[model samples]
Every structure is written in structure tokens, then in C-alpha cells.
Target chain A: MNGNGKKKRIGVFVCHCGVNIAGVVDVERVAKALEGYSGVSFSTHYIYMCSEPGQNMILETIREEKLDSIIVAACSPTLHEKTFQSVIELAGLNPYQVEIANIREQDSWVHSDKEKATLKAIKIVKSMVEKVLQNESLEPIRVGVTRRALVIGAGISGIQSALDIADHGYEVLLVEKNPSIGGHMIQLSETFPTLDCSQCIMTPKMVEASRHPNIRILTYHEVESISGYVGNFKVKIRKKPRFVDPDKCTMCADCEDVCPQIVSDEFNMGLSFRKAIYLPFPQAVPGTYTLDIENCLGLLPIRCGKCKEVCEPDAINYDDQETVFEEEVGAVVVSTGYDLYDLNHLGEFGGEKYEDVINGLEFERILSASGPTGGEVRRPSDGKVPKNVVFIQCCGSRDPENHNPYCSKICCMYTSKHAMLYKHHVPDGNATVFYIDVRTGGKNFEEFYQRTIDEDQVLYVRGKVSKVYKEGDKIIVWGVDTLTGRKIEMEADLVVLAMSMVQTDGVNELLKKLRISSDANGWLSEAHPKLRPVESLNAGFYLAGCAHGPKDIPETVSQASAAVAKVGDLFAQEQLLHEPTVVPVDEDLCSGCGICVTICPYSARELDKEKGVVKVNEVLCEGCGACAAACPSGAAQQRNQTDDQIFSMVRAILRG
Target chain B: MRIRNREKPFGIEKPVTARGQIVIIEDRCKGCGFCIEYCPNDVLRLSDKYNSKGYHPPYVAHEEECVDCGFCQMNCPDFAIFSVEVESGEREPAPAESVKR
Candidate 1:
């Protein structure tokens, strides 16, 4: 099998994997069959091929028999390819000198007939042996890692991740889109289950993050672009103009008082009014005031300089322009959180058009102690407490036809919390909740939902609110209770729609910048659903909070901590040794067609204009084989999974 | 199911001779009480004194009973509190550790 016409010395090791593979495939028979193969100088079967003794047997045979190539017939290559690769490398053989044949997940588990299974294992082993005969040595690419982390979004998840990374003595740049550091968590009244005040727990972390020497806060900024590989990421951030000096503007209301222009306060969900110059919230991390350039008359040619004149610190600057800056970091944590589904599109709900009908976030603002009503449950239609409050769950969720089919994980529990908070505000008030199903899948979440029904005396109806229309002074909700098989009509002063959670804005643009894939619904896809849940397929990037999926505060915090730990593990090392499983382009064979450059998702390929060929950035190549498949010429080829190796296996499989 | 009480039983402060000291990194403690919850011998409690960040850091309430297991340090997310072991037989003044904060 050697190219020099000398017989190749090869070894084959079969694994029992206890009963997983041994139960179906006859391991000794397969070993005996492979021992007679043309180039196999040594063959053996072990109880566990990945075990220390099993690996030792292969290493000993390699040294004793002078074996140049090795084939392992075990579980899928994904399960133990790296383990076997390291074993071969330790035995002074090239890592690429080894090949794995799928005998368990591909053969034994799929076939019931013992005869066919054993026969199939032999063919798979023969294919790998042929492939291993042509294997060449490969060395891993090492790159230096910057021990700094950039966390996008200053929500609870991002705040937690940034703080955790900073605690590990790594510098962190926490960037937020809004004028303030706190994200949606700052607007929440009280979290579910424990009922701990969200701001009470959140603001302390925000303040600590602001004061921490290792952490830097970047409010009112967005990630413009991201480039480079895992250990060295170059990020461009766009700093939106605040029109006020962040350092000089104290949390004083002087400018706010003097400003003649008034605008809807976004932090209050547009239910409250604030001057053109205002802070996002009272407990904002930086404690700085931002002037709304769009609404401020002073910024226009009208020459209204009232706010500038009254500013004690002279913070007002109408000429403030947006600035873009670049940063270099080793890793990034995306905790972009989530935005509520627009209930205005759901015409049946009569939300946004009607004053009394509101979304969950607006209700959260109403329940907040620092809100416009001062924690009072006052209806927006009239500044009076509503006696009858109704909540509808799954408004735009789990509806495949017109809305998102996936469950908005937090709606059920939060709706229950909303109902409970309503009852707490008005003891005599009647609280009713209409839900498709109650999904409380978190620690103490179910108990919290039950407490609202049992202890708080909130009525739970298992039904979908078909229609909510304003009739006279009350919003009439019509639906049918499925459990009782009867139609029910309820009149309510206030209606709260638990809107479905959607991915944060500018996700597609951010995804393009980060060079990562997202699911159809726009949630960031993890590397693996189970093993690598916190990490993205692209190295150095991590996902946290609702950005990955819908999750509660505790889960979000835990995930953020997990992401920080991952970043810390990466930062602990001086440099990263990337897998050598990248495709290399044979420049002579490449046509300079630029097909590979366009096909590569990682942007690892480029057409060399001078040479009239294509070049591959080995460090950036992810070895997805997309370019290899798209190449008209067989120039673009992966190192381990080359066209020849794959074709050899395919031919062997199809031989019989 | 009812609303589960999030807090564990608050430990009582008992007088003890000092065997070890748990240094409370004041600003780092978010008062999560993970250390108190994981302490095998119940040697720590949320301090009455507040840090600049307003979080009650975990303090050595029963220093004599402490075995220096380091479970508190291992479980702390913020790495705010860590146990510093002293000589097994070392005897120190009583109640001085309480007022040190």
C-alpha cells in the first residue's frame, strides 16, 4: 500500500465498548477478518478501545511491529477521534496516520442481523485501512490569545458574565445599546418564584460592575463589525451620540427641569413622559443623563439653549456626533437578551390601539416601584385602580400559522406573577388568567404559579382568548374554557397580553459580523444542544440568556456564569492550539474562479490576484468541506477528510 | 404547590474561639448566601455590616466550629469569600473577629 512499492505496515484495533458494540457485532470475528487484510501487520480487539489499556495495546503494537498506519473500528469518530489522535501522537506517529471506522453507531446499532453486521464492520475497517495507508502528518496551528473579553449587551445575563469574567481578573468591555447599563431586567418589578425585587438584586451588580477596575462599561453603543479568529478578535463598536457628557452629567435633574421639550419615556414603555434630557432610569449604572437628540429642540436651528444654560456641569453639547471605535479581545459573550413580540400585529387583541390593553413589559413598568404610577395598579385609560384585571398567555407564541411556533418559555410563569402582583396591589381586585397551558419549568417556578392560583385567589382558566375588544369602559374578552366545555365571557378594566419573546434587534446584522449561524426563528444556535450548549460553533464566541433561548433569571445567571467560566478557561492558557483539521488549497490546481472564497462561511478563502489562484487561511478554515464540494477542480481539500479518503471509504462500502 | 421560600434558615450568631478566618471581599459578595448554604458545619452567616455596594458579605460566625473545608470558596460564584486556615491549636481572643468588620 506504500507509494514506494514497499508493503505498508498497519494495525487495526476493534473495541467491544462493553455491551454497546459487542452485543450486536462479533468483535473477535471482525478482528480475525481484519488481521488477514493485505497491509495489516497487527490486529486486536479490546473491551474498550478508548480505555487506557486499550490505547496502550495499540501504542505497544505500533512500536513493536513498526506500524506506520493505524485503523480503529470503534464508536463514531466524533466520540473518540481526538482521544485516538492523541494516543497516536504520543506513540511518535503522525495524528493523521490514524483513521476511525464506524462499527457501533453505523453498523451494530443499525443492523439486527449478526452476519450482516459483522460483514459490514469488516468493509468499514477495510475502507479505513485503505484511507489510513495514504494519511499524512499534520501539525496543529497555535495562536496567541488576548485575555480580554467583550460582552455585548448589559442585561442581567451580560452583566453577570462581565462581572464573572472581571472577577477572574480579566478585563471586560460591557457594551449596551441603550443609554443605561441595565437591560430589560431593570424594568422588571419582581422576579418569579422567590419574588425578590429585580432591581434590588440587579442594581447592586450594576454598581459593582461600574466600579470594578477590570470591567469597562460602554452604554449607548453597538457592535458595528467583528473579524479575526478565536483567540484574537477585532471588534468595531459604534457609539451612539448621547448629546451630553457622560463624565460631567451627574444624575441631577437640572437639565431635565430646564428642557422645554417633552417626550415619551421609553424606560416607562411610553406610558410616562420625561423631558428631552433624562436618564433611562433612576438606578442607571453610570448615573448619567442623556439628551434625546431626536426630540430636543435645542439641537435644531431653533436655538433653544435652555438645557445648556441651566446645566451646572455644562454637560449639554448639541454638536455631539456618533463615534466608532475598535477594540481587540480574546473572546466575546453574546447576551443580546430578547424583545417582546409586537402585539399590535395581532389585531384580535386590540393592543396598542387601546389604552387599557397593554403588553407584559408595560405591566411590568406599572408594577415597578419607580414607575409612573409609583407601583400603583392604575389603568392607563384613567388614573384609577382597575378592580378586574385579566391576563392572556401565549398571545403570539405556539401559533404556527401567524406567529412563532416555539414556546415563549417565560410567559406562563411571568403571567402568573403578573396576576399575583395585581392581587397584591389591590386586595379586593379579581385576577383572572387565560392560558393555553402553564409551563413553569424552573426551580420553584411551578410552586410560584400555583401560589398565585391557590394562595392569592387568582382564577386560572385553561382557554385561549379568541377576541379582546373594547366595549364601553371595559375590555371584553371572549373565549371558551376547554376543561369545562363551556363558553365564557369576561369584562376587564385592564388586559395584559403575555407577548412572545423574539430575538433582539439587529440580530441578522450582528450574526453576519460575527460569522455565526442562527436558527430559523433567529435564536443563536449553540455548538451542540447538550455538550456545548453555552458555546457557538465558532470558537471564542459564547451565547447567554434569552439570546440562546427563553430562560428565567436564575437560569440566565447560571448560563452567564458558565460562559464566563468558558472564557476564563480559554484565557488561562497563553495560546490556543487549534485543530489541524482545516482544508488546504492546492494553488496550482485552483482556477482563481473565486468559488471557494464565496462558498466559505468562515471567510477563510481568498483569490490570490497575482498568482491567479486561491489561498486558504488555515487558522480561519473550519473544515466544513463546503468549498471542497463546490470546487469544480479537486483543489480545495480538507486535510483529514480529503476527497481521496472519502472516496476510498465510499468505494469500500459500495463494493459488496 | 405554593411559593417556595427562597431563603434558608438564618443561622444564629454564636460566640466561638478563632481557629480560622474567612476574608470577606466586601464589594464582591452579592449576598447570595451560597457559602452559608454549602457550609457543612454552618460556620458562616450574612454580616450585619454592609459593604459599599450594599451587599451583606458572609462572615465567620462560628470560627471554632469551622473545619476549613473550603466548600464556601469552591461554591462562591463571585470568588468573594475564601477560607484562610490557621494552626489547629492556635487560640485567639474571643468575639474580636465579630467586630473586625
Candidate 2:
């Protein structure tokens, strides 16, 4: 290897990309313009350098001309940087010797004037040529992968991701903050459009995840902290105490029946009662009961062991303590899902003040077959069937001044589903929906909404509900009729608010721990909006479900599978090869000052106590150069841009 | 104020009188052009002259053509315009004195 050589022969290849570049900028002219540049041994143009035929031309030229370095002027390097890097490597050249200049996205697409676009392409090509001349041959850095994955939150999205990843022959650690695996899906009576029972479809998947050999399901747990980079992450999970031995428990209801302490059942949206030792739902995965220690008689000062006395298996234990375990994983997939908007914030609707008002999730519980009233269309207050029910759409969505400005995307369909469900249950019941607009653009979604209105005879009112007030036995709904141009009022026994979806709590702390990016709305950001929707800027980490954005069941499941595919591709290789363009710390010049350590988003740098200097972890360094710029002593130098390289590049541009 | 005499030789409907002033505050207008777009009577127009922010503000080009419908004020996001209706054939001083008493 000529570590610091002077006599270098460079080859330049310009791609037309099928009129993507050549339609406006003349590719042949660019090659000709750069023909006589210093040390340029060969110059050529191809219709598409990324295609098979074009790659062959580049490989052949490198061999024939004995090109020491190469440059490709084409689309943004983000699109085909890896493709060209591999092409040069196959030709027996260092992959780091290749540099790409963007001309399509930055030039032709943005500029209408052909002459200006051509000139801009020429300048970009010239800068890349200058940089390639001084390029040093370098070796790719290799890091060992742990080959295990972590799935956060045991919701439907997390369950799907864990199962898919486990089926790919990799170990997965599935962590959940609740006592059991079926999340919000288990609370719903039925799904939309198809009217399929929610538990009928969700229970099987939960059981499979629990029984999968490669998956270790950890319920009633949360990740406390995460350290190290991808391929070597040490995660600490905190398991809360359930006061019950999970392994020893049998599918017996004797313990729950004897527990006299009763609390509001969250599974029924707090509209029903539950024992201290009770399952979240009758169909909960693993089918075990959790002893709520907070409310349990044994944990309280009163000391009651009624549940233990009744259990034949002696599964109830009051002495259990919280446990912490650490696991190492190569990749992590965050699928924390979403929480429904709180209706109490809308004071105009008499939200929590009225007993008849409830949010969508709570309404789902009331409609469930196992709910308090056994799936009867009765009011929660008096247990009497109501003559009329009113559903409010966009209660906390699409209101820029007081609520979320963005459309929740699922409200319109779910509200229509709720109305249709009510009409099906009570034949003579009157159902009315107050909405600003109806968006049903999915497959067979529009037909479902139409059938609800035309066949089911649910009233569709076009306007916003101004206020809701309690009137002794019934809630009064006041709204303007945009169609009739008059104020209308209705007395309904029940009101359902279609709430918005928001990010799960403590997401910011997780983002900081993982060094991942989030958009303005706090959903995880992807590498590219259209191309790499499942991948993040950091390698070995992927996103899925509502953590990425507001998506329905079909879209969320598809994206979860996509993330599994990406992780599988990464684990296929024994060792991961990283770009040599990472930042390096000069041991001689570094002073134990840890300025770069704090500014590094990835925590790639640390002060070595033995050496009394900063040490850079190559695996964690993404080469963003943020730490390098923060270095006060100028000791942290990013590869490919050593001080000498940047100085020379600046001089070349200024001279030209 | 003199009302139309019923016994006149040539009897005709008395001309309708005007009302209180309908004021338009120019500075608060955002020039969204909603007033001109929604006006049914075609009494409002976006002025060619620019405001302090260099946007064409809405102006009542035909002041006498206003119908006092209040449609323009309701549609305006910035609340730049409003209308008032007073009884015909009443002097401004007389009406002010009756309200004060």
C-alpha cells in the first residue's frame, strides 16, 4: 500500500441515469470537460452506472487503466453509495477510494434552466475529482455482532415483531410493562370493517409468542437503561413485583374468587370491578392471574392471605421483590404503540363531569362480550338501554388552537365502526355521528362506511358538537346543522368521543439512550422517508408500529415484518464491516479533557482512566463529526478528512 | 324628522335612510381575500395598494353597495370588518340622547 503516495491515476465515470441527468446536462460534455485534469488517467460516461452493464464497464476500466482511485457523478450518494462502493471493491480496489458527487436531486430536478444545471453538475464533479486525487487507501473496520434482538413493549406490534424475528432463527427478548401480553387489542370487542372478534384473533398470537423457543417473554418489566452501541448493547430491564409465582401458577380461578378486595377493572376501562388477584382479561395470554400488590390485602398493613388459603397450587406469594436482569442484543426494535387522548381536556364536552360521557377505548370495553353488562347496549350509569347514542369525531384532533393539528387518520373509520356496531346490537336504537369530514380511502373502507349509513340507517350529521351538558338522566348534545343552517340539540343516554393518538410516555428518555432521531411530532425518524421507512440513521436499530407514526393494523404489521427482514439481513453476515470514515482520536495530542465525550450523541468517546486520554469506540462512532468539531484540542480527526485532506481540498477549490 | 305625508298629491315610497357607520380596520387585516371570495353582494375587493406588510388588504370598494349581511365579518379570520344598522330618519344626536337617558 502506498500509504502517502503522490503519483495516482484516477478514473471518472458519469451516469446519465436514463435522462435523469443527461436530459438537461450533457454527460459526454462533462467527461470531456474533465478530460485533462491532473492525474486523471481515464474519463467515461454511461447511461446508468448502477445497472449491470454499466458496472461491468467501470470494473473493466479500472483494471485496464490501473486506476488508483475512482469518482462517480450521479444521483445523491444516499441512493447508490453502497452499490458503487462494492463495484470498486470487486475490481480489487479499496472501497474507500470511491467518491460520489450528487447531480440529480440537487441539480436537474431542482433547476429548470438546462445551462445552469449543467454548470452546477460540472462544479460538483470537479470537487469530487479534487477529493479523489488525495484519497488514501484504507481498510474497513469490522465489529462482532451479538446476534440477539430486543423488542420493547409487548403490544400487538411488539408481539408481531418478536415472532417474526424469532422465526428467522434469532433469539429475541420481548419486554412488556404490563402483567400480561395482550395489550389494548384485548380490550376491544371487535375490529372494524370485518367485525371479527378482537380476542379471537389476538389470543393465538400472544400464546405463540409465549411458547416460542427463541423468544423470552418478560411481562411486567421495563427497560431502565441501555448502554453501548448496536451489535453490543447492554440493556437493563426492571421487572416489577406481581406477588405471584408465574411458573407455579395453574389456570385456576379459585384464588381470584376468594380475594375479597375489589378495585376498578382497567380491562373494562374502569367501568367494572376486579379482584386484587385477577387476570387483566379472561383471554389473557399465559392465562395467569396477577396479584396487584398495591391493593392486595397481604401487602397492606391489614395482612390478609385469603387468596393463598384458597389456591390449591399455592401460587400466590406476598414476599416477591422486584428483579433486574441485563441482556446483550445486537439490534433493538421499538414498538411501544400509542395511548388514546384524554377526553377530560375537552371541558366543553362535559368530559369526565358527566357519567354518560366516555372515550373510544372505554366504549370498546362496554361493547365487549365479557364486559360488565355482558355486551348489552345499556348506559353505565343506570344500566338501562338508551334510545339514542351520539358519537363525536375529532374530539381532540385537527384542532390547531387547543388540540393536535394533524389528522389522527383512524378516527373517521373507528367512529363509523362504533356507530355500525351500536346499530347492529340494538335494532330500534338511534345512532348519530357528528363529524367535520369522513376519510375512508383504504381497500373496502369506503364501502363499509356507505353500508353503515345506507343499510344500517345510522344518521350522519355534518358539523362539530359545540357542547355537551348533563340534564339529570340524559346528556344533551348541542351542535350546528351545517345542512339546515340551524342549531340542533339531542338528548342521548351515551356519548362516545373518538380521541387522538399520542406518543407513549417516556419516549424521549428512550430516544436519548439509543441515540435515535425523532421528528417534530415525536415519532421515531427513519433514514429516508420513502425508501428506508423501517430503518433509522443508526445501524442495527429499526422502528415499527405507532412509535413510527399513526398507522392501522395492516400497515403496522407490514412495517413490523419489514423491520424483521432488515435485521435478518444484518445477522446473515458473521462480522459487520463499517465505513473507514469514522472519527479518530489522536492519543498524543489529546489531554484527558472530555469535551468530546459529552457532545457525542452516540457516547462513542470516553476518557480512558489508564491512559489519561480520550478513547473513541469505533463501533459507536457514526462519523457525524459532531464530536470532532467539539474537540477543543483539535485532536479528534474524522477519517477521510484529516487536517491535510481538508486543507488541500480548500486550496483546490479556491485555486479553481 | 319629517315622515312622508300620506295625503301627498304624488304619493311615492320614501327613500330609505342610512345607518350607523360600518368601520373597517386596515392594520389588523391579513389579506386572506376570504371576504372578497365569500361576499355574495360583491361589495368587497382586495386593494391593489399594499399594506405595511406588502400584502394587498381587503377594502370596501363600493361602500354604498353594502347590504349589512355580516357575512364578510364572520368569514374574516382577522376580524377586520364589522357592520351596524340604525333606524332611518333619526338624527345621530337624537339617537345618542335617547340611549343616554
Give the TM-score (0 to 1) of chain B in model 1: 0.64
Those runs of model 2 whose alpha carbons end farther than 4 Å from true positions after fitting are A1-6, A14-37, A44-57, A102-130, A251-260, A297-302, A309-312, B1-101
TM-scores of the candidates in the order shown: 0.81, 0.80
Q: Model 1 — TM-score against the truth?
A: 0.81
* CAPRI classification of candidate 1: incorrect
For residues A514-536, could you state the per-residue lDDT of candidate 1 as single tens digits?
Answer: 87789999899999999999999
lDDT of 2 by residue, A1-656 (tens): 13566677889999999998899887888888778787778899999999999999999999999997889999998789889989999999988889998888988778878887787777777777777776777888898889999999887889999999999999999998888887777778888778889888899999899899999998889998888776778999998988777778886877765554445566666565555678887667666789877655344323446577778888877778898989999999988888777667799997577767878887786677877668877776666777799999998889989988878888888889889988888989999999999999788889999999999999999999999998878799999879888898999999999988877778767886777888766778999999899998878789989888888777888999999998898888898887778888899889988999998877888899899999888877888898777788889988886666667666655654
Quantify all predictions' global Cα lDDT against the true fold. Answer: 0.83, 0.79
Please report, as a residue range, the 10-residue window in candidate 2 chain A with the lowest summed lDDT.
Answer: A295-304
Measured on C-alpha atoms, candidate 2 has an lDDT of 0.79
Q: What is candidate 1's CA lDDT for residue A453?
A: 85
* Candidate 1 interface RMS: 26.6
**What are the chain A TM-scores of the candidates, in order?**
0.92, 0.91
| Model 1 chain A lowest lDDT segment of ten | A295-304
